[model samples]
Structures are given as C-alpha cells and as structure tokens.
Target: MENTESRNTAFEDIGQRISKAAKASRRSVSDIELVAISKTRTADEIRPLLDRGHRVFGENRVQEAAGKWPELRQDYADVELHLVGQLQSNKAADAVELFDAIHSIDRLSLVKALAKAMDKLDRRIPCFVQVNIGEESQKGGCAIEDTASLISQAQAAGIKVAGLMCVPPSNVSPAPYFALLAKLAKGNGLKGLSMGMSGDFESAIMLGATHIRVGTALFGERSSAG
Candidate 1:
C-alpha cells in the first residue's frame, strides 16, 4: 500500500527543505536535482520515495544496481538511475547498460572499459569525470591534475565526457573544492560539476554545482554496501 498521505507528507517535508536551502543559497529550487542514493535500500523504502514522485535514484555498486534496477525499472520505468560510486572495469558492461548517467567515471581503466562496453552496444551514455579534488587516498577518482587528460582521452575513445565530480574533505568547508571543480570544468570546457552530498550540497551549489549526489539527507543512512 502506497499510503498516499504519508508519501505526500514526506514529499512536502523534503520539498520544504529544498525550498529553504535553495532560497538561502540564492539558487532556484529547480536548479538543483537530488539523487536519492538508494543503494542497499529495499523496495519497501524506495517504492514510497518513488510514490512521492522522487524519480532520481543513485546506486553505489554495479552488482547491486544490476540486481535492484531490474525490479525497480519493471515497476518504475521513469525513474532516472545514476551510478554514484566507484566503478570497476570488469563490471563496465553492466554499468554502461544500467546507468543513464554515471557520476563516477574516475579511473582510466574504467573509462576505457566503459567506452568499449558502450561501443559494443552501439550506444553512448553520459558520464561525469570524478576528480579526487581533496586528494583522499581512500577516494576513487582521477586527480584534478589528471582530469583534463582523462576527459580528452575519453572523448577521443567515443565516450562523451560531460563534467567533473568530487567529494570534499569532511570536517572542512567544501566550497573551495566545489569551486575548484567548477573552475576546472569551465577551463576544460566541461558542462557538469557533480559535487557535494547530503552534508555539503549547499556549499557545492554556491560554487556552481550542477549535480548533487545526496543520500542520507534524502533517504536516511544507506547500508554499508549496495
């Protein structure tokens, strides 16, 4: 049972949050789109979110997306799926097929493999180049220094490199990192700046973020793995 009343309440609450944040940031509510990272989330949770008309969905792992997307798509074919986690070369084919847009085209191997997979399928999916702007060793992305070269290489290989993505350091302001990614995108002639998250998305928007991969704030804490 959807329980339309509960769905409406959740939608209104999240919309109000979006409204207040957008006003405070001096941006229009439509300027930012929230991707509900539903990785590791069961359909019982997702169906309600979708029922509320929240169509943007994000997943972290390829296999999890592979498993979940089929059922989700069967039910909610209109929801847009985004891959917001590290992608592996071995799983590139499935990723290429599953995601409408991949926000984590980070490594050279993954990019190359994605190109190959799309080529084999005779398709070209939109992709964002992940930049480890904060340079965290645990983070998976091409460094800011390597982003331009990677984007050029991907474009040459027939992959459409649309923009830059990054994760800012925790406990520090994310504005600089978001701004840097925006500058990098403009300097390199890229269009999308995929930065920020549940915590720092406002900072990201202030710095010209076109895409914010929000998770916890939208769907609560996700499971350890998706």
Candidate 2:
C-alpha cells in the first residue's frame, strides 16, 4: 500500500495530467469530472483520497459499495458515488439508494428496474447508457444500434440519462471508441462520456469525455485479495 504522502502525490499527478489534456483539447477542466475508481479498495485505502478532498468515486458492485460507503459517508457526508460496472436487474433498488449516478444501464430490463427503484425511493438517479463500443460478447453494454432507444426509454421512465459510458477493447488505440461514444452521445443529445481508465485517460479527455474513471493511477495496483 502507498503511504499518505505518496497517495496525495499520485492524485496531484493525475490532476495535472487531466489539466494538460483538457487544455490541449481546448476544453474547460472544470467541465470534466474525475471519478476515482474505488472498487476493490478498502476504507483505509480510500480515506487518504477522501481526506485529500476528492468527493466523487466509482465502484463496480452494489454489495461492495453498500458494505463500505455507508460508513464512509457518515464521515464524508458530501461524497458522491457512481456505479461503473455490470449491474444485475435484481440489484436495481439497492443501486438506486447507493449510487449518485449509474454508468452501466445496458438493457431494457435494467432500465425498467432502475426506474421502479428510483420511483420507490423518490430519487431520480442520473444514468449513463453504456454502449458496447468494441462489440465484444463478454463485455457489458448495449449494442450501438440500441443506444438511441435505450436512452429514450430511460428518459421516458423518469431516469436522468446523463450520457454514455464504454470500456474500449484493450491493447489497442482507444481514440476511435472514444470518438464513437462522443458521436453516440451527440446523436442522442447527451453530453457525459464515462470512458477512460488508468492507462488511457489522457486520450479519453482529449476526445470529449466528461467523466473519466481512473483506478490504478490514483490508488496504485490492487492486490489479488481485493
């Protein structure tokens, strides 16, 4: 694990990189939100970033976030949580209560479930329609062709469709996928693009991403146990 000073340094470095990317692309750094990916990270590990005043974070599972954030939020009351991984329809109610935003609405069932959960909770949680940019069978996102309908359906159900999110195919250039996501968001009249990670976040910012999900770059490598 990294010491507190080292962790702060890493956070500063990522902020600087984000500024550089935003400036080079002629975009306002303030318009971009950095969601420190906090899945698989323990409370002790996450506290430093919280202490450093990073309020927005992303998690991959509802159960894992439920286990940790409730306690963390008691202390850092302003923290915002975003769900950034595959979500089962059964967990929709739990997710509606926990996440400030959800970035994995890839199907009609999940959309309907989220709508029902949000209605019951009386919280209209914002959502990102995840698009399968790479078209890989193993990944979790709606088909590109389904993007418009899904966004429209979510909006109709009173879900705040914020934008689109994607995990581009690894070991290749991500610009094309980022560009495609931007195009999809534009076509759908959406703006948020949650599409970056540890290795290629700079490219993501350059290509009009409003939300970049960063993990290892801020928290360092995760152990297998996490």
Candidate 3:
C-alpha cells in the first residue's frame, strides 16, 4: 500500500509537470498523452501506475511486452500499450495483435507487413513513421527524404499513418529535431508527433508533441528485465 501510494505520488507529480508544460506551450493538458515507458520494468513495478489510473504505457520490444502485458491487461482492461522500439518485418502480426499504437514504423517493408497483418487480423493499429532526424547511420528510422513516400505507401496499403516519431541525436539540443518532426507531420497532414523521452519531453510538448514517451523520469532506472 505504501509503495502504491509512492507510485501514485510520482505519477501525479509527472502529470502536473506535463500539465504545466502544456499550458506554457498554449496547448491543452488533456491533448497530451503521457506514455509511461515500461520497457525493462516488470509488471509488478508497472501495476501501481495502472492502479493509479495511468492507462497509457510504452514498451521497446514485442517479446518482452508479450511476456507480461497480456496478464496485466487481463486485469486492467483499459490499458493502452504502445510499441516504442524498432519492429521487424516478421513480427508485424504479433505487434499488431499486441500494441495499440506503434511508434517505430520506419521502412517500406515494415509498412507492407503491418498493412497485411492488420488486414488479415482485422485490426488497424495506428503507426508513427520514425524519421531518422539526425540521419545517423546506426539508427532505426527512415531517412527524412524517404519519409513522405513511405507514409504515402503505408496509407495506400491501408495502414493508419498516425504521425511522425524520432529520437534526436544524443548529447545535442533536441529542439530543432522536435520542431522538424512537427513540421513534417503537419505538412503531411499527420497529427501525432511521438518524440521526447525523460530528458526532453517538456521541450517536445512545447514544439507540438501529441504523444510523449517518458521512461526513466517516471519509473526511475531499471536494472534488467532478465
């Protein structure tokens, strides 16, 4: 009970901070969805947040999420799970079945696979096209030049292109990257911008992020899922 109260307190503290940030940005607090990232955290660590009424959560891998969330969701039916990690082409069907939103749709092949999965399973999960905003060779998003075409192709294949997502270059100011992602989303008629993590979520909200994926700030440091 004490632990649950602590969790509730922490969740409310973050919510208040997010609300204040949204107001400062001239956006309604209700408009922003706080996705408490539960990547390496166990369901035991996550349930307190769920008990405190945090319905949205993000995970980095399909297998890890699969290990826990099914049982958690069985208890809390209102949970909205998001995939915040890179998705493989072969995992599209499982991803479609598990996640409510996907924030890492980055390539043409994934676009096609997700489309087919959604069609075959009769479930359409919203997807955010991850743009390689920093253009890092080792990252997981599509190149900025290819973003528009990929989104178009995804749309053509009947996948719901929700918006754009990006992880800015580390150790650099993320404002420009967030602003650029917002610009691209607006230009392409997309609305959701899935950016920002623990450190820069306030900046992202200021720059028009409808979905902020926060992990460490809310959950503290995770040891290891294993």
What do the candidate models score in CA lDDT, each in turn?
Answer: 0.82, 0.94, 0.92
Candidate 1, 1-226: lDDT as tens digits: 4444554565576667766777887878888777877877777777878876789889999888787778878878898899989888898998888888998888778878998999898878889999998999998889888988999988888988878888888898888888888899999998787887878776776777778877666656546674
Q: Write the per-residue lDDT of candidate 3 for residues 49-126, one digit (tens) a residue.
A: 887778999999999999999999999998999999999999999999999999999988998899999999999989
Between prediction 1 and prediction 3, which has the larger TM-score?
Answer: 3
Candidate order, lDDT descending: 2, 3, 1
Candidate 3 segments exceeding 4 Å error: 1-5, 224-226
| Residue 72 miss distance in model 3 (angstroms) | 0.5
**Candidates in order: C-alpha RMSD to true structure:** 2.5, 1.0, 1.3
TM per candidate comes to: 0.90, 0.98, 0.96
What overall lDDT, based on C-alpha atoms, would model 3 receive against the true structure? Answer: 0.92
Scored against the true structure, residue 198 in model 1 reaches a CA lDDT of 78
Q: Predictions ranked by TM-score, top down?
A: 2, 3, 1
Off by over 4 Å in 2: none
Residue 123 lDDT (model 1):
74
Candidate 3 contains a number of clashing pairs equal to 0
Candidate 3 TM-score versus the reference: 0.96
